[model samples]
Target: MAAMSKPYYVTTPIYYVNDKPHIGHAYTSLATDVLARWKRLEGQEVFFLTGTDEHGQKVEKAAQDAGMDPQSFTDRVSQSFRVLAERMGFSNDDFIRTTEPRHKAACQELWRRLADRGEIYLGAYEGWYAVRDEAFYGPDELIERDGVKYAPSGAPVAWVKEPSYFFRLSKWQDWLLRYYEDNRRFIAPESRRNEVISFIKGGLSDLSISRTSFRWGIPVPGDEAHVMYVWLDALTNYITAAGYPDESHPRWKFWPADVHFVGKDIIRFHTIYWPAFLEAAGLAPPKRVFAHGWWTNEGQKISKSLGNVIDPLALIDEYGLDPVRYFLLREVPFGNDGDFSRAALAGRTNGELADALGNLANRTLSLIQRNCEGKLPAPIENPHLMHDTTLHSGISDLREKVGKALEDQQFHSALEHIMFEVRYANSYITQMAPWALKKTDPVLMLQVLRLLHDALRVFGTVLWPFMPTTMDALLDQLGVPKDQRKLADLATPLPGGIPLPPPSPLFRKIELAA
Candidate 1:
């Protein structure tokens, strides 16, 4: 595909500051980071934003429980998220806190727009509110568990009655359905799209847009007594980070985000409520909102209560970053729930990161260093291949194959094809017996080694978005410059005599205690 001339904007849902950073947060952010990196590599201008949602009743209560003011509490916890992003190598371009002056301005501007359009109205809200989710549910949507009510999502809910401001969410139901029908991709994963359609068909009630009981939020534009709904203030962070209320802002080109990467739990907000708010404000909805599935630990649900919320930092410390990142996209289909296991992580590290890509890089680079005078060898003009079509066909068609896979959001498939090439390289080396070729026909050995260099060039370059650090270091070892690391450079071979860095393993095996 030709490079996109238009800018690409992607976002991870602004995480709630009520909780600390976890693997679930890392999963969404990392997936978006990969997409942002891919778009930049594709030669498109990209804006990637992620940050904390610092308001809501849940946050207010959490702060009180922590014995601190809301701002101080959010500040402390939000820094953990920022630190997590930095340590995980997330390439987020902007991190917006809702409490920031810029974000407050954006939220108020949006609220005023909706209010002017008659989409906001004074009302009282009485419903079962899930403190954990910061969401309210209808009577029919609640379930009883041991004499306590819970949202369908299993979050505990308590009755909330307060003076509130309501958004005219019901008015947009038909329009939203039509939009979904017209766009077809407004919500991703056919299953998710179907679910939204069915839910909207069942009905959409007007949404509570302001809470009078909670003062720890962006106050409603004209009414100091009410605060903007956490969802409204939170969703506006997208445009806020895009420099909303200022068309001249350079990042405004990224309005109508290319994609909103969110978890399935929040699909209702993104697919329905967020679009309604944007349309009410006379703005276009984001191109897509893809809600990915959750991760369980070792076939059991991962939860704080269970003492099994996986700490992404600890995981990275135990296993290197690239392998951990690789395992995430590789182990699960992007939109489906996955199981996390130390055993699975260690196995993939040893098997693929260590045995396949890492082992292949060392073997090929070591051959060049020992046999080719520490430089790339000359390639034969047209050499006869002695191997089967399996690998050549795969390696040759890799760019288009992987590109299509990524475009389709088939991350696992893309990584699978990449590892396929790695396996093919290993098989090809064994088939040609490059070491033996060195003694029998040194010239043919050079051809095999050159072939290995070209093949590694393709896979390593393709692997960059998935495993940036490892691929960058691997490409550097192959003598490929950073400027030439785009998708267009995948099939391009290195010049014969570029000096190389000494080879080292890209990933290490994580040994588990026996």
Candidate 2:
């Protein structure tokens, strides 16, 4: 029997439309993009979805402040997110907007189903609410500072009491605990798992699922007087994108998403509230939810008040997309907090990209053009030589390790492994002194050139997912077929004596000013 095909379904948190796209949003999307691209390269059927969360009190207030209708405001701001995704090379298959009619229909259908199941009920809600966070807080979660009571934000919270509907979240606490205990990988990083377990152990509360105070969100089924809470409203986006509430819909085949890539701050909503919501509706929760860490700008938390929030578009415009993507994944471990700085970005691009990988390609291909008459020279087969054997064996090992790293979602490690091979190739060429060999023994020089070509071809194949355009250019210079550059071809050696083109410089060196 043939091996079964794997399915990969991934999502980034639907960004709230109250603010424009920022580095935080870009971070989540980029991480998901890398995963989706890698899985596709590995021959998995991938469904990647990302979109905007357009309905909330914060969005309403922001629209009002901007002197526009909520719909108009959201439309304009949401386009910024789409544009950013395209600019950053995101390959998401679907972009969902909560304001879309399809999503509204799905939300209404879900609400009715939960209501019919006796999971939703009317009640009064009075608590501290944060407009910025769109979250209701209990007394214990509040902090008092400077004679003002706040909901963990420095801004004072307004007291309001309103009739609302609630979800029986407390009734599902035992089930959630059992689910976590049985499925140890439900949350990520082990540390995040502990945090989530602690939060759930503190005791789950019946969640207020509807808000009578806000009229700017998805209206609750059978009750136009209230709208669904922002968390519930936002969490439904995953199923909405998969065409839920209409089981006959074609996209429903991808339901019960394989993975949801979210930020650590929102893990509770994804792990606790999202799973509970799915269970109440007789649906399966996503197979996994990986909550990744935050980023600070130059060692300080990004703050508009501090005037240091990083603009992703500006960074892309300044440094280019792949460099930004590479720096982000390479600079830090995936689940740990990282600091971003212009100096750090420049250093990695200059040292790893330009000097190491890029320069090696430039020199090797230029030598082929100048010394080998712009054609690949046939490699001399010498199984007895230790260096040749070692190079081949090392590349085969790298192929295996890179595949494992991608499977484990360790993109930084995968990229590091590829660059390590590049470094090895550069050193091999230097030690062999291929240029001198051309004068001493032309046949020996051809063998050395063949090794360089084979190394570059494999490097390009592994790198295609991370830096597509750059890798394509590198392969073109080596005269390798685009079709032959699939991920599975990493172990295959290029046929020698293929005509090559003069090497164009892959990356330019940058000088730091004194």
Candidate 3:
């Protein structure tokens, strides 16, 4: 495989640290992890980043509510997110926090650049602000419910007046429109791109870039009285992971991120404010930002008051890590909202993973172990059968097919392609009647077994990025070496007579709690 010259940088938005880690956090991180691993499989250098957004008024109040100082509160909550990364098997290259000294420096430096460019100025600000969202809302955007104002998100809003530093967002309105038009794929999923364009065309207002009310954030450069806004501080975590201020650090090679995976709720901040901020700082904006939709639990909106939050840790404990990972991307189309139900997860786990994939590997390998002296059979040399030829051709074309789907971030489509091969292999084995061939024509049985082995090898290798642990164990039984698991290595045929390890179940069928 010819590797690309430039490194691929992928990031999950730094999660707000106001609450415990939930399914939304896990979904974004897992999606980014899959992309990072796939790039690595294709022989490219990859930098994956995930972290906690540790500043803002919401966090300050949360800290006080928890009876802890802001720093201590952030330290504790941020560690949980880090632990979530570990528990989910996320291969993030770095975990950043807005509270980190390196990140603070980067944020302040960006602020200075914007200010020096005449993009920032001190001003008195007043507007309806949602503390829960850390966002400002125009009167038109707020809905009155029971004589009380709430943001469109249904979060209650309160009027606040304070001296603040403002960014000249209105100045870049026309320029941003042209940028979006020139970089057609900059904002993803088509739907989100249109949403951003419409919002910008509606007219831009100067953004509040600093807050004097909350002291729990990065202090403004040359002015300690105000701290930089949370979105600005949080967004800088991307470049901070790439060594922003110094720019000479080795990791800086990954600047100008390949893609940023963010929840749709935050698309405006990322696509609008983030790019504008980077441009004001004389830096290039990230190449692409993909905003994926939310997940509802059992057809009900997930909320704390509703008591229906889907805890990913609990799901992993109940099911399995890899199964949860597979179901997450495989169950829903990319960039579309999905409903999470115990029934749907269990059905996918049992139907797709266990019945379709796991069974294919188990029965095929068991036959080879039992009938072929527990050794890997040689590749089929003379396959006059059209079924044999067709299966070989399909597996040969499988990698590129899956790659195209992933390039579009169509994760479900990528998995569907893989599962198609699995289902085909299962059907091929059944029709070939490898068990009967063992009695009628033992020689033909071995050839069929070899074909099955090759299919399994390709399946295990391609699936490694999505389900590493399970695929690792599956590949272990196939006698594939640790270093020989890249997508390029698929071109090399698996050598026969390799001592195969004893077969074991890769995924177990599980029952969810009532």
Candidate 4:
């Protein structure tokens, strides 16, 4: 594919500050980071944004329970997310907090625009509200169990009645349906798209845009007594980071984000409410919203009450970072709920990382270093007919195969494609017996070694987005230049006789505790 001319913009949902950073948060951020890195590799200008959503009733209550002021509470919890991003090696261009001054200014300006467009009106909101979800559910959408009401998500709800401003969300229902129909890819995974369409077809009521009961959020423009609803305030972080409220800002070119990565629970908010607000504010909706499924630990629901919340940091500490990153994206198909068992993690670590890719790299490079005196082997002008054709074909087609899979956000398939080549190279090395050939046909041995070297270069460069640190080491061992690591470079051949650094193992074999 040709290099993209327009900036490729991507974002993770700004995580709510009421909870500590968890695997769910890490999963979304990592996926976004991988996409951002891939786009940069594709020679496209990219903007990746992630951060904390510090406004909401849940945050306010959490702050009070913790005996701290709202800003102090958010400042403390928000920093944890920043730490999570760094710990995960996310390549976000900016970390936007909802409480930032620029974000507040952006939210207020959006509100003013909506109000000026006559899409806002004063109203009293009386409904079942779940503080945990920061969402409202209609009577029909609520479930009653043991004489108590709960949102569909199982979060407890209480009756809330407050004088508030409303966004004319119902007015844009038809427009949104039309938009979804026109842009079929607006909501991803087909099932999610259908869900959003079914929910909109049911009916959209005007959404409560301001809350008088909560003092923890951004105050409404011209209405100090009321604060903008948390979801509206939170969603504005996307454009705020893209320099919203100032179109002339350089980053504004990245507006109308190429994609927004969100969890499945919030698909309604991103698909239904966010677009209506943006359209009313005379701004474009995001091009796509891909809501991924959740992760369950040990085949059980992961929750704080269950004491089964999989801490990403703990996983990283126990297993290496790249292995953890690989397992999460590789273990299950994207958009499907996955089980995080130690056995599954260990299996992929040992079987794929340590044995397949790592073993291949170790054997190929060790042979070159020992036999070729740590120099890159030269590729013969005319190679062995049978052994060379298939491996070269696989390596040559790798860039296109991986690129197409990644474009559709198929992380598993992309990694699988690379692993196919790895497995093939391993089998080829065994079949050709390059070691035995060293004494018989030294020329054929060098040719076989050179083939493996070229394959490793391609693998390292393409897999860098998924496993940056390990791939960086692999590329460095191959003496690949720092600047010459783009996707386009995969087609270029390296000159022979360049000295290579000593090979080191990319992954350690992990033994799961019984």
Candidate 4, 468: how far from true, in Å?
A: 0.6
Cα error, residue 102 of model 1, in Å, equals: 0.7
Could you tell me which 10 consecutive residues in candidate 1 have the lowest summed lDDT?
380-389
Q: What is the C-alpha RMSD of each candidate to the true structure, in Å?
A: 1.8, 2.1, 1.4, 1.4
Estimate the lDDT of model 3.
0.91
Q: lDDT by residue for model 4 over 321-427, one digit each (tens)?
A: 99999999999888889988999999999998899999999999999998899999865565547455889889989999999998888899999999999999999
Which model, 1 or 2, shows the larger TM-score?
Answer: 1
- The regions of model 3 sitting more than 4 angstroms off are 1-3, 381-387, 512-514
lDDT (tens digit, per residue) of candidate 1 on 216-300: 9998887999988899999999999988989789999888898899999999899999899999889989999999999999999
Tell me the spans in candidate 4 whose CA falls farther than 4 Å from its real position: 1-3, 380-387
**Number of backbone clashes in candidate 1:** 0
In Å, residue 333's CA in model 3 sits off its true spot by 0.7
Clashes of each: 0, 0, 0, 0
| Residue 267 alpha-carbon offset, candidate 4, angstroms | 0.3
| Worst-scoring 10-residue span by lDDT in model 3 | 379-388
Residues 1-514 of candidate 3 have per-residue lDDT tens digits of: 7778999999999989998999999999999999999999999999999999999999999999999999999999999999999999999999998889999889988998898999999999999999999999999899998999999888999999999999999998998999999999899999999999999889999999889987888999999999988999999999998999988989999989999999999999999999999988889899999999999999999999999998899999889999999999998998999999889989999999999989998998888888888899876665556345877888999999988988888999999999998999999999998889988988888888888888999999888889999999999988889999999998887777987877889888978677
Residue 255's lDDT in candidate 1: 89
